[model samples]
Target: MRRSMWRVMGLFSKKRQQSPSGSTSGQSCAATSTTSAYELQEKDLGRLHRAAAHGNLAWLRRWHWWLKRVSINRRDKEKRTPLHLACANGHADVVSFLVQENCQLNLTDNFKRSPLMKAVQCQQEKCVAILLEHGADPNLADADGNTALHLAVLSPNTAVAGLLLEHNANIDAQNQEGYTPLNLAVSKHHKEMVEFLQKKGADGHAQDQRERTALMVATFAEDMNAIQLLLWHGADSLIGI
Candidate 1:
C-alpha cells in the first residue's frame, strides 16, 4: 500500500513542480491521476479532507516542502491549527511534519482539546498511534475528566486503547461522573472492549467512587455478552453480572 501510494505521487512529482504560485502545494493531486476522471478542487472541503485524512507518509516524505508551505497554518472556521486538522483527520505524517515545523501540540482552541485529545475524540486511531509514539501524554485528561482511554473504550477502538495503555495510561482512570473506561465500555455494551480489558488484567471488580462495578454497569446496559465475559474473569459474584 505504501509503495503504491508513493509510486503514484512520484509519477506526478515533476508536473506538480511547474505551478509557481504555490497557492496550494500539491493541491488536488487525485484530479490528474490517470485513473481518476475529476479534479479534487471541484469537490468540497472533502477534497483536502480525504488527502489530509491519511497518515500519508508518501505525501509528507515526497512533498515535505509542499506540505510545509501549503499545509502549515491552515485551519477551519473554528480556529484550530493544522495540527488539530491533522489530528482530527488522522494524518500522522502531516502531524509529524507539523510538529517538527513546531506546530503547537497542546494548542487548545475553541474546544480546549489538544491535537492529541482531538485525535482520540474523533477516532483517528493511526493519528493517536503516531501521537503517542511522538510523546503525547496518555494520562492527559480533558474538561470532563475523560482521558483518551475513556474515549477509546467508548468507541471500542482496540488498537487505540492498546496504544494508550502501552503508554502507561491509568487503566482505571475515572471521569467527571466517576465513570472509568470499563464503566464506559460496559455501559456502551462493548463486549470486545470489556473482554480485552479483562484479559489485560483490568480489575473488572473495581468500581469508581460511584460504587458501580463493570458487571453492574453491564447489567444496567443489559449487555449479556459483557456480563458473561466479566463473570468468567473473576469479577466479584457479589455484583450484578
Candidate 2:
C-alpha cells in the first residue's frame, strides 16, 4: 500500500510541472509579440521624421492622404514632430506643405522648443519666414527659457533677429538666467546685435539674476566697444554691481 501511494504522488508532481512550463512558454510568446508591435510603430514614426528632415517631398506627398491615419503630428521618443525636423533642416517646401496641412504651428518638442525656434537655431531664414507668416509664435521659450529672439541674437543672425522682432518677439525677453537678448549679445561681444536690440527697444538697463546690467557685464569683460554701445544707449552703470 505504501509503494502504491508513492507512485501516485510522483505522477501528480510531474503533471503539475509540465502544465506550468507550457503556460510560461505561451506567456513569453505573447510578450514577444507585444514588443515587436511597439517596435514597428516606432519605425513607422521614424520614417516620417526622416522623410521630412531629408526633404523627401515626394514621399510626403504620396502619403499626404494617409497623414491623418498615422497622425502627422505624432512625436518621436524625443517629442519632435515632422514639422520640427523640417524646420530644423531648412526644408522650406516641406515646411510650407506641412503648414498647409494644418500641422500644429506652435507644438513644442521635448525641449519645449517650437518649430520657429528650431528654424532660428539652424539659421533657416526662409523656413523662419514661412513659419512666421503662418503665425508661429516667436515668443515661445525653450527648456532654457530662451526665446527665438534670444537664440537669434546668440547666433548673431541680424536678419533672423530682425524678422523675429518684426513679429513682436519680446525685445526685453529674459531667459532662465534673467539675461535679456541684449545682455547675451553684450556678453558674446556681438556689436551688431547689441545695436540692433537696443534699437528694437531692448532694455539696456535690464538686470540679470545676479543684478548685473549689460553695461556692468561689458565693463567686467573689458569690451570697450560693448561698453561704448551700452553707454550710448543710456545703460545705467551705477546699478547692478
Candidate 3:
C-alpha cells in the first residue's frame, strides 16, 4: 500500500506540458516561417489569433479595414481567444493592445485555462504583470482546479509565482487533487519554490485528498530540504497519512 501510494504521488508530480494546438514552445521570429512541417502555419490560425500570436501590431491596429469583419475577441476552434494566444506566446504588446480594446480578461480556453494561467504556464512575466495590473483575477482555476499560482509552482520561476502572490492569488488554493502549491513544490523537489511559498504563508500542514500531508509527501519523495522547511514551519511530524 505504501508503494502504491508513492506511485500515485509520482503520477501527480509529473504532469505533462499541454500546449495549445498549432503552438510550439520556444519558437522565435528567426525560425523560418515554413522550414519544417511542425512549425506553426499561418493558415492554421484565424486572422486575429495569428496576428496576436505573432505580435503583428500593424494588423491589430484599431484603424485596420479588416477589423470591421473580425471581432477583437474572436476565439479559434479550441475556444482560445486572441488574448490567450498572445499571452501564451509572450506577446506583451499584443496583450496590452487587446486589454486596451477591453477584451474579456478571464475567458477560458478549451482546457478552461485563462490568459493569466497561460501567461504563468509559459513563464511570460511581462504578460502576467500586464494582465494583473489590468484587473485580471489571479484566483481563477483552470480545468484541473489549479489557479495561476498552482501552475506557477510547476516551474522554478519563483518570480512569476511571487507576482501571482502579489496580485492576491490564494496561497492555499487546492487543485482537484487537493494539492496546494506547497505540496506541488515539495513533490517536484523545488526547494526554492517551497521556501518561497512558505514565505507567502502557504499552509505547511495542508493535506491532499488522500489525507497525505505536505510533510508526508516530502518524506515519500525523500526531499530532505523540503522536510526541514516543513518541519521548521511547524508541520506535525507525527501526523499520519
Candidates in order, TM-scores: namely: 0.65, 0.79, 0.80
lDDT of each: 0.62, 0.74, 0.74
Over 4 Å off in model 3, which ranges?
1-41, 62-69, 237-241
* TM-score (C-alpha, index-matched) for candidate 1: 0.65
**Candidate 3 per-residue lDDT over residues 1-241, each given as its tens digit:** 4443444345333322221311211121111112111124667787788888888888889555676566877877778888998888889998998998888999998778899988888889999999999999999987778788878887568999999888888999888878888887777778999999988888877777757677766655556677677767766442532
**1 or 2, greater by TM-score:** 2
Q: Global CA lDDT of candidate 3, please?
A: 0.74
lDDT of 1 by residue, 6-25 (tens): 33334233323533322232
Give candidate 2's TM-score. Answer: 0.79
Q: Candidate 3: minimum summed lDDT over ten consecutive residues — where?
A: 28-37
Given candidate 3, what's the lDDT at residue 30? 18
Error of model 2, residue 36, in angstroms? 33
Task: Give each prediction's root-mean-square deviation over alpha carbons.
Answer: 19.9, 25.2, 9.9
Error of 3 at 221 (Å): 1.1
